[model samples]
Target: MAVTDPVDIRLLAALADLGKTAVHELAAKVGMDPREVAYRLVALSGSGLPLLVGVESDPQGLRAAIAGAPPSWANRPPQQQFPAPQQFAPPSHPVPQQPAPPMPPGPGPQGVPSGPYNVQGAPSGPYTVQGAPSGPYTVQGTPSGRYPGPPPRPQFAPPPVPIDPAVSTWGLPQTASWARGDEPARPAATGKRGKLGEVMETQGLEGEQLSVQLLEVQDPADYLFGAAGYRLEAGERAVVVHTEITNRGSIPFASLPDNYLELLAADGTAIGKAPVSLTSRPPHKIGVKPGETLGGHTVYVLPDATRVVSVRWSPRPEPDERTLTWSIED
Candidate 1:
């Protein structure tokens, strides 16, 4: 029959271009795991496609296969052994001789014996060299070929500046209204839980005030699934949750407000939202500007038997005290 899956089609196309290749090589070309590629090729062949998947032994790997075996010479007979090549003595040659010259020396330049010395000028003693500076030098203050004294050390350390608890350590304040010891303390995240339809005030990582409200929850939302041309497995069902978020502080909430919204099952399991979207229901946009409110619907697909007890929202991947949860009633 015909190949419909995009991945299979791509793999077949790459195979056609390559004519014949190993499974790993084909996988590298199509960006798939070698095991997966081999499985797919076998499956396609079983489907009556003209494909063959098999492995072959490498002839060049015979040595590796027989590793730890005795050396070839160990099994050879004495009569079959080859003799070592003979060594010949090199021919001798007479080197030329020369007459020696007379010597007349006590001390050479710099008062050093007529031998190698590291000093440039006359040496005062074993460790001291004449015409050289005696002290350390600063990098920028010293001139070329001249040494200067060590850099001056500060007399005392500067006084420590007091840290304001209200100021954020991330960076400078975003707005002029935010000043040290002037802005009110942030509200504690304790007791942030509420029921559906109740407005919950929360803060983002950047301390942006936000008002989040769970507007609606539609369980077993099969109509949205069928309308959006999507299908669910036999035992799975879809859910749609409506939420509204309003930015109350001067800073903008740049993250998707409902990105972490999940359905908490009665057994303490968290069902995350599906990646699919419904055309009729708008998904949460990227950012919510200051003083602006936006409403969006989040969709989830879970087992039909799961009893969703509450809807939870978090600014991060994991839930924390800052996370807001709204209870769902049967």
Candidate 2:
């Protein structure tokens, strides 16, 4: 966030005054090497300074910054170069003193007098001493202090009042304009959607980037079926459902390791089924290759009844009953 220094400041000012100037010419005016000028320009460009546009200035638009311009600051006859030092002269006159009585409005010498004192101790202009404006005017005085009014006003129509578009973050054109049109649209978000269901029915639930995907059924029926060859009465699956998986995920465990698929029932069917440490299915390596699909399933029984029946299948990973009931809007 280094800021532009005095050199940059002068460069910018000169550029404004010169409009579109060549780098070499800019170097000359601002007193820097052409290379340095280019470097500074680049630095300024990077710093989000005023935008530089490379277009020919409209001749009519530039009239105000040129000779015989509308503004007094820019108005000058041709054949004259910049910094016209001798162009204006302050006519000599003495600093007018306090009025005789200094009675304002009642005025001896009307309004405050202006300068241009002569060697003879006389005001070069008939600048009034202290009082109100006699008639908004400047009076030039002779060496002897004889005052004379200004010459007649020039006969020229006033300059047109141009619109000022000076958006003021930078002192860029107060009259710049833009054309209108639509811009290009942005990209849409993207990702894949997979079917979530019973292990046998579910699609891939693989972990993202680098890990094994998991699908578990903690619903009581799963526990009952895993523990007991028979799903117990009033028992439901503790393992709600299982996810179809592909084990490509990185793990601290070895590629080939013991794993089990189990169903637990709320009604103690698991202990009855077999009380082995890892019961239900025999252990297998889970050493699945990428994209490999494996199936597993769970079942549940009705609660508070000796009756045992396989529960109807439902959508896997549905957020809630409401989600299942929601209708697709047209």
Candidate 3:
């Protein structure tokens, strides 16, 4: 019951990072099978981990599963467990017989037709039957005495069941560990604000320490944007923020370092980062190794009238105390 398995620990750590993801997606994150993920979650929940394991089923699929019937999506005929009963019928007409040929004058063998005799209306010979069908005689239906071989065995192929776009194959958990009060409260954000070119250390999702610094801020970067073969809408201007991230802990920082970097507007609205990248200004790569440093450029397009206040960075989707902000000077 105690969570001591290394695999279970890894699964829990991934679940903590992912929050509420599908079982298969969580499995992909941990390099395990979806069924295994589901089983482990169930076991962990049973062990008082406060984990929630839930399933979603198609209405028709539930009925089929309960009734022991093939799902409608399969589009197959009902299986015939045994071959159809064989039917038999007597021949429609009797086969005609011919009279024996006349024998020689000498006394013939007693009770035997001594001379050549036509058998079954054919020229006389030993063990010959005239007009007999080549194979077993037809037993039923048609008057013709020909046997049709057993009905061709029904051809069956695995059914192509349609997957529901809304549901994952391994189903989804209704609630995550955090929602079930299993995870500790998120760390409070430090009240400190750094100016541009100042470094601030923060903890990553996996407890890895990282040093983040806002290196440069470019306002009205339209010329650079245009040079990148991109066009902006009228009244829109681009801003590019360059930052450096260094992993200071032994653990590697595996996520995009600037994923949640954004600009705070003068009116307190948060402007999100754009996906556009500049070729000359290389964008942030995926990860930073331990003791390694990486620089990244984040681009944002906003209305020219909007006054940018500060640059904010957070490791999570939502800004928290761990988030760092750098005031922008006009």
How good is model 3 by TM-score? 0.47
lDDT of 1 at 275: 78
User: What lDDT does each candidate get?
Assistant: 0.70, 0.38, 0.71
Off by over 4 Å in 1: 1-191
Q: Rank the candidates by lDDT, best first.
A: 3, 1, 2
Error of 2 at 232 (Å): 1.3
lDDT of 3 by residue, 1-330 (tens): 467899999899878755665676567556577888899999898888868887653453443344444556333332443334444544345446766555444233234322233345443222433433333232333333333332343545444455434333332443221221234446555445888889998887778888999999999899999999999999999999999999998987877777778899989898877878899889998779899999989899999999998998887655666788999874
lDDT tens digits by residue: candidate 1, 41-156:
99999999988887654222323324433567434543344443344544444434543232234232333323223323333333433543443222333334432332343223
What TM-score would every model get versus the actual structure?
0.44, 0.17, 0.47
- How accurate locally is residue 101 in candidate 2, as Cα lDDT from 0 to 100? 38
lDDT of 2 by residue, 1-330 (tens): 545588888778767654565565556545467778888787787788774633334443343334345465433332232432333444775555643432223212434443322333445444443343443444444334543433433334336545334421322332223211133323332122222232222222222221222244333444545565554443332333333444443422212211222222334232111222224533233335544545343332334332221122211111112111111111
lDDT of 3: 0.71
Please rank every candidate by TM-score, starting with the best: 3, 1, 2
